[model samples]
Target: MTITALRTPRRLVRVRKAVTRRFARALTGDAGMSTVEYAVGTIAAAAFGAVLYTVVSGDSIPDALGGIIERALNTRV
Candidate 1:
C-alpha cells in the first residue's frame, strides 16, 4: 500500500538474512572438539568412573542390599 510499508518488509527480510548468515557461520566455523578438550574429557570420565567404582564396591552398599533382600524373603506373608 504505502511506500514505507513496502520498504519495511524488505528491510526486515534483509536483516533476517544477515542474521541467519552470521548464525550459520558461527555454527560451522569450528571443526568441533579439539584434541586437548578430548583428552581432558577422557581423563575426567575416567576419574568419575574410578570414583563410582570405589563407591559401589564398598561394603556398605552390598550389605544394605543383602539385608533388604533377606528381610523381603523372610516376610511372613
Candidate 2:
C-alpha cells in the first residue's frame, strides 16, 4: 500500500474516534439534566396556567365582571 493511502485511513479513524468520544461525554454529562429540568418546568408552568384558566373561566368571575361593566356602561356619561 502507498504511504498516502495508509495515512488517509489513519486520519479518518482518528477523526471518527474523536467524534465518538465527544458524543459519549455529552450523553453521560450534566448537560443532559438541563433538558429534563426544562421539560419539568414546562409541564409545571402548563399545569399552573391550566389552573389559572379554570379559575378565570369559572361562572362567578364572569358574572361579577359582567355586572361591573354593565353598571359602568349604563351610568351617566
Candidate 3:
C-alpha cells in the first residue's frame, strides 16, 4: 500500500525484535545459568544420597552386584 502504512508494520517488527533480544539476553547471562546449574547439582546430590541410603540398607539391591561383592570378598586374587 502506501509508505505510511508500511511504516507501522516495520516499527512493530523492530519492537518485537528488541523485546525478544532482551528476553534472550536475560536468560543466557550468568545469573540465570548459575541458578539453573545450582538447582541441577542440588538435585543430583539428593539423588546420590537417596541411592546411597538404599544400597547401605540392602533391602532390595541388584542380585548381580551383591554376587560380585560376595565373590570378591571370598577370593584372594
Local distance difference test values of all predictions, in order: 0.96, 0.94, 0.88
Pairs of residues at least 3 apart in sequence or in different chains that clash in candidate 2:
none
Residues 1-77 of candidate 3: C-alpha lDDT, one tens digit per residue: 89999999999999999999999998988754477788999999999999899897774667767888999999986
Instruction: Show where candidate 1 strays beyond 4 Å.
Output: 1-18
lDDT order of candidates, top first: 1, 2, 3
| lDDT at residue 66 of model 2 (Cα atoms) | 99
Q: How should the candidates be ordered by TM-score, best one leading?
A: 1, 2, 3
How well does candidate 1 match the true structure in TM-score terms?
0.66
Best by TM-score: 1
Tens digits of lDDT, candidate 2, 1-77: 89999999999999999999999988888844587799999999999999999999999899999999999999996
Checking candidate 1 for backbone clashes, the offending pairs are none
TM-score, every prediction: 0.66, 0.49, 0.38
lDDT of 3 at 71: 95
Model 1 lDDT tens row, 1-77:
89999999999999999999999999889787899999999999999999999989999989999999999999997
